[model samples]
Target: MPTASVKLAVIIVSYCNVDDVDRCLKSLGRSDWDHFEVFICENGGEAAYGKLLTALVGADRTLQRASDGASALDRPHKRLASVTKCRFQNSAIVVRLGLATENLGYGGGVNAWLEPLLGVLGWDSVLVLNPDTEVERRSLSELIAKSAEGFGMVGGSLVFDSAPDKIINYGLHWSRTTGRVIAIGRNAPVGSAPSSDDLARIDAISGACVLATRSFVEDVGLMAEDYFLYMEDLDWGRRRGKYRIGFASKALIRHVGGTTIGSAVAPEKRSHLSIYLSARNSILFARRFAGWRWICHFGVGLLFAARYVLKGSLSAGRIALAGLLDGAKGKTGRPDVAPRPH
Candidate 1:
């Protein structure tokens, strides 16, 4: 088959994690298909950190044929090239060091700066990757291939940081039968190899590593800005039926989850915010576009809330319930800063 003529532009929104940024850049060097450019949007730092990052990751070096240096992220990069069959022939450059004056959370930060740039450049696809993740060599090729198969949004499997053998996410699943939200291939150890055909038909894909077409962005718009952090992906996913969201089993990214937003162990407010936004926006999303069957969506969310409470996340469960109520009441919460764990 002939290779598709789509050019890709990668957008990574960075927040206070320089090491991860370095690793992420290193992984980009391993991309199997390289007709792409990358834009790193850094938020929540003084200029110094971004400059230091650039120095370490070759920001000053002019874009040329891909070369090598002694950075730790580079060694594995070289190994990737030796093993992978796909060509990493990307022409890449760090256009500018983007540092926001203040934090814009996730959705706000990415949308404000990157969307306009993507629109102007006319890239066929825009990949929004978490700074904490590293892509495998075939990652881009797989995403491109799957998108070519008719999915507007393409997501890959995420391996756990501590146990690279373990799969953190395969894709997102919606259970119309149970109203439950499920993640495909969760906690399955790597090399286990779940069927790619299953992932191709998933209900959604997490935003941690998603490749979306320009049409997806223009139609759905940047994630609902009101969501700030959580559920923005789910919101985007729900809208995807209009364009058909899908998963790319061949593409892979490893994520060090909970680096930015702490997990359930985080403080009450932090945990609460995650639950709140997830619940509220999910309901808001279902209500707005779920058509006449929203009652089913509501029922499923309630059951999902019960599971959280049963799991001993009482506060988080309460927040989820409250968010549902708020969404039902059409209450729009202000974007607030919840403390991050140390």
Candidate 2:
């Protein structure tokens, strides 16, 4: 297939975080690849956040067109080598917003835009990214290049936004026995490089930033919507067998982990919502995929709950136990809980 025919669609799912969305869009504006479109999927955020995202998209579209014109010929970037001049002239990268009437959860928000993205827009590939992530200028190009090399699902390197020099994840590994998802290179210095073999295959890739081809989506299907917020990526990776998952080390993305779910909250006082969803999803994933091994997972979960209790987080421990019970009973969807008092 010709490079021009390989169109990229970028999808970002956001909820009540307009500032992070703004920063993410600005970073995207610096992308060297010009053959992509951005879709912002707003999942039941406040009206103010929706307005801000709309305004930012308008400004970004104008700026992108202007910059494309100014740099059309003069000092052409090396990354534009694959792009034909004719295609570049006719193609206009656009940013669009898709607002949801209600909270669609993480998987649902991205799925909501799949029809229009794959069918109406006719994009060949889709990059699902979180609103709290900022991509490096060459990130998209690197991911697209890897995709062309036949990787069905390609993920970028994620670095900590707070500690720019520290790596957060190069890929992920899910253990069926323990029902835990492990980060491949957590907290390692960015300068340290992994062996080529290590980068070649991983159990899974972080959903914070992943690029998937249309063929892969068609064959493997979209993220499991029942997971709602957590463990959907693990489920997707574990189930897909037709295509291999790859990591693009050259593509760098800075992620502010848990921005939407309060990563900043002290471990001892973490929000009930976060604790509940994580526990419930882990059990659900284990039971669905691990079969009888869920007994081992239950034991591991008990240890986790006990740790929280030892740390004086009584609420977190109790919520986690409740989640485990609910998940075993086949309960799903967003749970109703009152907002935490300020």
Candidate 3:
């Protein structure tokens, strides 16, 4: 029997990664838990929405439901996104595609679905997932179990999809002293647990895979949209109020890291956007939460920019400096640069 009591809505805020969304939807289709529906917000706008429809059809050629067939009350996020293109009722998965007219960044994209899904459609919980991640069959079950254990927000273990034995992170460690956000268990072997020392400084869970109860969201409020992309998850974690955060190592997931954004094994080879947003968000975060220590965050941004210069990536250094200046000038929301392509 389905756990009708636990109404979970898995939210995936996708930019332009239709293929990744397809694979992720296929993965979600295998979930053992039977009380959840998926809402994918296509933040990449109309073109990506077209790609999403094609991918959805390819993912499941079984049932087809046109937007005109759905009632206004049945389809949530339609007020924000376009609407569901097709649906699959055979498995536990129910895919609803939300097409945005413009890029909503990460937080904005996720927020587009939350208000309507949690309110009008009526789901008690939401699991924010990256389109590039494929969760384990028991992932949802573990997250719900952890949340039932009293955690208002819960995160699962994330391993690299390319190197399944290597872990991406268990959570995140936000450094006040150095203004660095380090993955708690970066590159560690699979199935390893975070030590107490590591857990002590884990200020936030990785946004790659996080679940939150409706009560916590209603109390703490929705994720801040000011951070259009990076650092929004850390900001969300810091605002948990009286609620507690937890980790479910058993809820294993494989993440094709930085799919929408370019990445490299080496720090110097990372994309300009990644470097820029990281440096900018650090200062913005400090200013809002770090009191006078915002200066330290600014200094850290300078250090980051210098790293690129030392590594002979002057263009990256320039972008990093721009991010620092923008953050210092109280810049909020998405940068004016074009997003990476699908």
Best of the candidates, TM-score: 3
TM-score per candidate: 0.72, 0.85, 0.92
Worst 10 residues of 3 by lDDT: 69-78
Per-residue lDDT of 216-287 in model 3, one digit per residue for the tens?
Answer: 888988888887888889998988878787888888999988888776346677777777787778889888
Tens-digit lDDT string for candidate 1 (1-342): 117568787877777777777678778886777777676556655653446344443434322324443333222221111100111223433323355555666776567545555436546888888888999998888888888887788877678877787787667765544444677788987745447676554666787888888888887777666666765676677777578766666677888865666653443334556667667766666666666565777777787678777876676667778877776766654434253332
Q: So what's the TM-score on candidate 3?
A: 0.92
lDDT of each: 0.65, 0.73, 0.79
Candidate 2 vs candidate 3: the lDDT winner is: 3
Candidate 2: global Cα-lDDT?
A: 0.73
- Residue pair clashes in candidate 3: 82-99
Candidate 2, residues 7-67, lDDT tens digits: the string is 8888888887877887887788788887787766677555744464444534233222223
